[model samples]
Target: MSDDLLKRTRAVLPSWLAIYYDEPIEIERGEGRHVWTADGTRYLDFFGGILTTMTAHALPEVTKAVAEQAGKIIHSSTLYLNRPMVELAELIAGVSEIPDPKVFLTTSGTEANDAALLLASSLRRSNQVLALRNSYHGRSFSTIAITGNRSWSPTSLSPFQTYYVHGGQRYRSPFAGLSDGEFIAACVADLREVLDQSGGDVAAFIAEPIQGVGGFTHGPDGLLGAFAEVLRERGILMIADEVQTGWGRTGEHFWGWQHHGFVPDIVTFAKGVGNGLSMGGVIARAEIMDSLGANSISTFGGSPLTAAGALANLRYLLEHDLQANAARQGPVLFEGLRKVGSPIVGDVRGKGLMIGVELVRPGSTDARSADAARGGGPGEPAPEIAAAVLEATKRRGLLVGKGGLHGNVLRIAPPLTLTADEAAEGLAALVAALEECTP
Candidate 1:
């Protein structure tokens, strides 16, 4: 039956699109952090659907809310008020520090970001948006224009020439080993150059609180705050693209940028905003959002089902105190990985549950010989090591994801529901995978 299903899917789907893995598994069901294949194989999901399943899959409360909402109504155009939408907005505002926040719902992070970008650019009457080189905003035209990753922004050149600024990421910092102040100064200098070079055309300086796809990496301490200060000075609105890092994933606060002591003019969240349901939004300072009142809106945005799921997911995360749990378990997992002490483990960096393990050519091994044997040409970024590690982990019934421009970093972002014992199990599997993949 499973083979027949796979054959049917293969026959129906287009072959030109890239598959995520060399071999893809036919996942049948999920609960908590585990997923079962159609053939009865269970795999522990460390990536959590790319960190979208914050509350984990098949959460009873969220499922019940979604079902109940389905019975009532699915969607009402933004032109009319919906009960669940209002309640969801209130719930989000209650958790945020922003007073009198206004919410604009969308179906995905990309649309949310696109809406934010349009608002920011329109309000400031500026065409340039400054973003970090390693950061990801989303894939739509306006959002992708601001996204810094080349993989997503793949044309030889952007038609609109979307401007960007640099941020302080210490792992591969432009100015490594600098003090926090020095690093921030460098980042600010880059922003200044971009702004000046663009003849002050910059409207907003946008960034992720901590870069999620860029190896689950943390930015320099106080770097975001410093950038905010610079933006304030230059009249550039600060936007936090917290789509991946928000909602207590960082543990210190509900919003990822809160730990930095800075508030964004516009904050967008998706991914786990609805705990795996299709929902996203931009929470803005009331004044900023109001400025764009008539300029933008979504047809199916703020649907009752999405709102219900979001409210339930938010409540569940808050009620269970999962943020604090992420904080506690993050260090435990980090310490265990560090103790394993493989030479291939070049760096481990993150906050809370969002972690990145950077793999490099181990100093103890002959890098050239290893690359030759692994079929990776010289200076090919060593993502082959990451791939081998992932394959080995999967063999042991564990799953994880790779990130970084080079795909050489292992990203560990399990559901917020992760337990200490479960973390230990996942970490053990990772360690074993590393040992197996090391030269």
Candidate 2:
């Protein structure tokens, strides 16, 4: 059955649209933190549909709200008075830390970021932009221009005259050995040098508090705050692409950027708000959000059905204190992964529910070859190893994900409601899988 669906899907879908595993699993249905394939095989979900199922799969409140809203209306365009939209916006604005916040709803994170790019370029009146060295904002042509990773961007052309800066990945940095303060200073000095060469203040300095597609790695805690101070001096707007790092997924803060001392001029979000529904939005200070004078409306952005579902999901997340759950459960997950003692697990880091486990070349640690392996190096990122481990885990009734610049990292972002027992079970399966692929 799965094979038939895969064949049919390939017949219709674009080749560039990637799927997980060697043979794709046809997800038929989900409840809570587990999903069943077409073959009736159930697996405990670790990726949470790429972290889209924030609270959990098929959450009752979200489904009920969507059903209720759909029973009345699906969409009425952006021209009408959208009560659900307004309510959700108000809820977001209240929590958004930006001063005098305003919300502009969109259909996806990509569109939300597109809207943010439009706002920044218009308000600052310059097409020059600054982005982190390993950041990914979105897939749109405009957002892709600011993305630093070449593998994802696909094209050299850009809507903005973009410059990539350092400080996204501290692990791979030349400055990796420096202290946090010195590292921040070094990055700031580099920024100055880059700006001096450009001879202009960039329109905006866009970044992710924690880079998602760049192996889920991030720099020292205050790196962005340091950059923010410099960008602010030149009146450069700061755009926080919080698509994956928002909604208390990072645990310590409600928003990822909040881990630092700065508040961004614009924040874009998506992929979890509606608990499976398509929804996203941009939040910013009132001044920046309202800068453009021309008329604009998203025909399908703020659908009442989506808004209702998102609002209910938001309520459930807040009421359940899922952030607290993440904070508590995150350590358990981390510790278990560490104790797996697999030489493939090189580094495990991230905050809250968003964690990244970097897999390195196996046999790097050995009794006789220990020195040789250490001298031979961090071993090229082992994507094939990661792929094998992913399949092995699935065979064990556990589902996980792989990512990174070389696609060698395991991204374990379960629902915020993850339990200690579930985490332990997943960890055990992960260890078994890692061992299975160790050779």
Candidate 3:
């Protein structure tokens, strides 16, 4: 059944756009942490659709809310006020630490980020913005501009971003030789330089509390606290891109920025907010959001249907204690990977469920043998070990995903509903895959 479906998909879909994997399984449905192909084969899904389905696939409450809202109204123009939209705003405010959080809803993370950039620029009356290197905001023009990835080719990048700092690569940080306090001081000094050199032209400084796409690197508490202070002193808005790290995925904290011990002027969120429904948002401190004079708006930004789905998802997450589950399971999963002791595993770091295991080339016999224990390479592994692990896991009734600037990091983000037994199973599969690809 899966083969037949795959054949049909290939025949109908554009070949150039299709990313063909070795095993072309046609996924038909999903429930909890499991996804089934048309052939009825089950695969434990640790990827969670790249952290977009936190409450798990087809959650009853979310599905019911979406169904009921569809029956009522699929969409209503934002020109008119909508009840779900209003209620969702209230829900967001309750969870947010911002005094009077004002929400600007969007259909996806990119839109939320775009809105954030616009809000920052308008609020500060400046075009210069500072961003951290190796961050992934979104694929929109403005968001991409602020994104510091070297691979990004954002069209029309203003000649004017003040200076992008590199953050969260503590092992090889730009401030590697400095003490924690000195490192914090260095980061703050750099930003102060940028702001001073640009003569306070920066409107905002955007960063991810935890660098999700950059291999789940968590920011040091003092670093973030000091950076926030610098931006605050300069009167620049701080935009925290919590698209991947927010909405209970991080476990211990509801908001990733809260982990840093400061509140952002604007926090952009998406991914898990609607449990796979198309909903994203920006929560701003009241004064920051009110800076604009009501001329800025999105047509489908706050549809009643999407808002209803968000509301239900939020309730389900809190009531079911999914955040607590993420917090609980996250440590277990990390320890399990650590015990694998695969030499190839250079780093195993993340908070909550969002995690990554970096693969680098071995240097010495000890390093090689250590990686040999887990099956990793020194430089870019000749055969793409991570890709092999992805396929091997898929073949063994599990689904996983990969990411990183070099696409070598194994991204292990599962639904908050994932059980300890399920996580153990995933870790076993990962270890087995690592062994299978041992170079």
Best by lDDT: 2
Give stretches of model 1 more than 4 Å off. Answer: 1-18, 156-160, 293-296, 364-380
Provide the TM-score for each candidate, comma-separated. 0.92, 0.96, 0.90
Q: Give the TM-score of candidate 2.
A: 0.96
Candidate 2 Cα errors over 4 Å, as ranges: 363-377
What would the per-residue lDDT of candidate 2 be over residues 1-439, giving only the tens digit for each residue?
Answer: 7788889889999888889988899899999999999889999999988888999989999999999999999989889999999999999998898899999999998999999989999988889988888788889999899988877889998889998888887655666668999999999998888888877757888888888888788888888898999988888899999998999998888899998789999999999887778999999988888899899888999799999999999989999988888889888887877787777887787888888988877655322332443453344477888888889999988888777777888888898888888888888888888888887
Ranking by lDDT: 2, 1, 3
Please, what are the lDDT tens digits per residue for candidate 3 over residues 1-439? 6677768877999775435257677778998889887879998988877788888888888888889999999887778889999999888888888877888899998899888888888888888988886777877777777776655534655534646775655533546446777877777777777677887778888888887677677546656767888788778788888999887788889988877778888999998897778889899988888888667557787788888888998998888888899988999888888887665676677888998887654442223332434543234432276777778888788777776666667888989899989988988888888777666
Candidate with more favorable, higher TM-score: 2 or 3: 2
In lDDT terms, how accurate is model 3? 0.78
All candidates in order of TM-score, best leading: 2, 1, 3
Question: How well does candidate 2 match the true structure, expressed as C-alpha RMSD?
Answer: 2.9
Superposed Cα deviation of residue 409, candidate 3 (Å) = 0.6
Score residue 69 of candidate 2 by CA lDDT. Answer: 95
What tens-digit string does per-residue lDDT give for candidate 1 at 335-357?
98888787778778888888888
For each candidate in the order shown, give its overall lDDT on alpha carbons.
0.81, 0.86, 0.78
Consecutive 10-residue window with the lowest summed lDDT within model 3: 363-372
